[model samples]
Target: MSAAREMLCDTARAVFAEAAEAGMAPVEAAGFDLLLVPEADGGFGGDWGDANAVLRIAGVAVPDLPVAERILSGLGDAPKTLHAAATVGLMAGAMGQALALSIEHVNTRQQFGRPLGKFQAVQQSLAVLACEVAAVDAAAAAMAARLDAAGLDAEAADFEIAAAKLRANRAVGIVTAVAHQVHGAIGFTREYDLHRVTIPLMRWRGLHGNDAYWAERLGRQVAGFGGRGLWETLTARAE
Candidate 1:
């Protein structure tokens, strides 16, 4: 990450961490909603790349407010809804929290006189969970970079955005299943914070365009290119 991006992410992390610690609602977390709006528009003027980092941090915090939707509404013509990349970022954030919680739980919780993490079964499950999280994060990051480089209006970005959301939606089910399996009964309980991330992930997967929806869209886009145009279409840039 560039120095500027790192600093922005750090600032976002601090804001989200403070809000989570204080039990503040997501919307009530001050300054977050302004990150994506242009300064000329009476906002911070940060772009989608900056908002990508913010959404990841918010996902980890899993606050009660709709941070993703707020950012989307402020940044574009969308009807106050979570866009594909934002949804991916949100799921990535949730997976980060879930993975950390699962790791902590496995290391602390014991069975048969050893840490749960020491068990081979648990190790394999955790490994899969980690891979899923990494995949979603990578896809979201790629889409963010694409958007930043091409400008948000560039139609060339649609394929990558759709692919990221599709990958994220698919990964959520696997990540959530593995996380819940790792956490066992404690994960399902309302008292534990795992539900905060897991529930939102589940809900977010169906929003924007779900896996099936994106798959169809992608297929149609590819089909329209035909055999001769396939390679160029994949590599094409918006005019």
Candidate 2:
């Protein structure tokens, strides 16, 4: 990340942490609602990359406070596709937190006179969880880039948005299962921090759109492009 973006994320981390305690008031006071608007329009003029970064932090810190809605408010009458793309970023962040919490639990919780992290089964579960989290993170990043490249036009970035949301939705079952499995029954308790991330991830999977919805939408877009056109378009978009 660039220096500016690093600073932005740092600020987001702090602001979101406070928002978690004080509700949307802290987020609104921080001006995240101007995240995607242009400076000429009396806004921050930050791109989707900036919004993605802030949203990811919000995903982990203030998952229930309408952070995504506030951030996307800059776009009047935004399409569902854009909201779906934003949800992917939030899911990615929450999934990442799930993995982090799972790892922390496994390393600390003891079983059979040894730390759970020492067990092969626990390690394997964590590895799988890590892969899913990485996939969602990659999908979210790609979607954000496509949205930025398309000037935040939902129609132009529909394919990426669909794919990202589908990828995130698909991973939810595996990620949450593996995270909770590794953490055992303690994960289900209200006192644990694991619930903070896992619950939001489950909620986000159905928010914006669900797995089947995005899967079919993605398939239609891919079929429209056909085999060769799909590859060409993918490469062209990457370029």
Candidate 3:
């Protein structure tokens, strides 16, 4: 990562750690407003990218909060549905799902009277789960860097964010399904917290734009770009 991106990520990690440890509520509006304000307005004079970095950091630290809303606002009223699709909520929900399943499978199941987690299949699934969570973290950070660089065009950035969200959306389903499978029938029980993550995944996946919606958006955006438009503008500008 570039120095600037690294600094932003570090700042976010510290802020999130403080919030989590203190059990603080998310200050959505205040956080966004602080970042959105111009230097003259006593703000950071930052734009969407800075704000996006803060949101992603917040997600890494505390995925439960609605940081996606703040990020969506940067895009204007593209559509409420589209806005909902902008968050990393699906990704967060995936992590929660995997964790829940891991806990359940470790406690339940039987193999030689031992829990299924002792088996190689379960271990491999767990490893993949870890990888998925890491991918979300990295993708979110990379997107934030692109936003910060001002190298991406507005529409292009929106599409990129959509793609990320779309990936997360699909991942949530895969993770949750695998989790439930590893967990077996017990996972479907409402008594378990697995539902806590799965329910949110179901809701979040459709929030902004589901996989189908964003995929279509990306398709249109790509086809619409003929060549020397936004890319040219960004390239021509002096850094």
Candidate 4:
């Protein structure tokens, strides 16, 4: 990355970490949204650029304290209860899934006939978990970008947000499953936190729309201009 990009990422990481910490408190912090407010909101206005910057940091923090909900809620006139619920749901689900994976590794991983988190495979899983976390962070950033540019237009911004949530939701499953398999039998235990993320991941999959639903929606969007004729229509419209 360029020096400038690196600088921005570093700055965003710092602010996001602070925000994430505040978000984890027993009570929500004051003016949390103001830090990421768009100019239209009468604050130091920002766009997806700002939101993504914040989200990437928040993902790193993964505090599970409803940080994303509060941020998204503060953006407009008030967000509906359902909207806030969905926002927080996705963020919470993502964190839960990741945590579950870690717990699974630590418990089931046996090395030298003991827990393998005591060994190498478990360590590898941890690395993979980090990558998954980073991917989700990037997805959050991308979703914020679409929202900033397009507002809440269903075809544009909503679609992008849905896509992001969809990917994160699916990832919750993939990460959890693989981690559990690697963990062996102990991952199924009620004593594990892995279940916490697994339960939410399952719920989130159906909460909004699933992969097939979103895929169809995206397909229809591409086909809306007249199936294969969309490109022609676009060219003609441009002309």
In order, the Cα lDDT scores of the candidates are: 0.79, 0.88, 0.60, 0.55
lDDT of 2 by residue, 101-183 (tens): 88888888889999999999888888898998898888888888998999999899898899899999999999999998888
Descending-lDDT candidate ranking: 2, 1, 3, 4
Best by TM-score: 2
User: Per-prediction count of colliding residue pairs?
Assistant: 0, 0, 3, 12
Error of 2 at 229 (Å): 0.8
Off by over 4 Å in 3: 1-33, 36-39, 44-67, 70-86, 93-97, 100-111, 151-153, 223-239
TM-score result, candidate 3? 0.62
Tens-digit lDDT track of model 1 for 1-239: 76877887887777677666665453455666677766888987776778888788888775455777776666567631237677778788888899999999999999999999999999999999999999988888778877776666436577678778888888988989999998989999999989999899898889887789989977887788788787785465322
Model 3 agreement with the true structure over 1-239: per-residue lDDT tens digits = 55775776676666667666654443442455455456786665665555555654554455566556554544445455335433663355346546656757666767798888888888888777777766765555555555455443444456556656766776776677777777778778988666656666667777767889878876776567656664763354313
Candidate 1 Cα errors over 4 Å, as ranges: 17-29, 39-43, 79-82, 226-239
Best by lDDT: 2
| Model 2 Cα shift for residue 131 (angstroms) | 0.7
In order of TM-score, best first, we have 2, 1, 3, 4
- Give the local distance difference test score of model 1: 0.79
TM-score of each: 0.85, 0.97, 0.62, 0.57
Quickly count the clashes in candidate 1.
0
TM-score of the candidate numbered 1? 0.85
Worst 10 residues of 4 by lDDT: 80-89
Question: Compared with the true structure, what per-residue lDDT tens digits does model 4 show for residues 111-144?
Answer: 6678756767666767776666566656665555
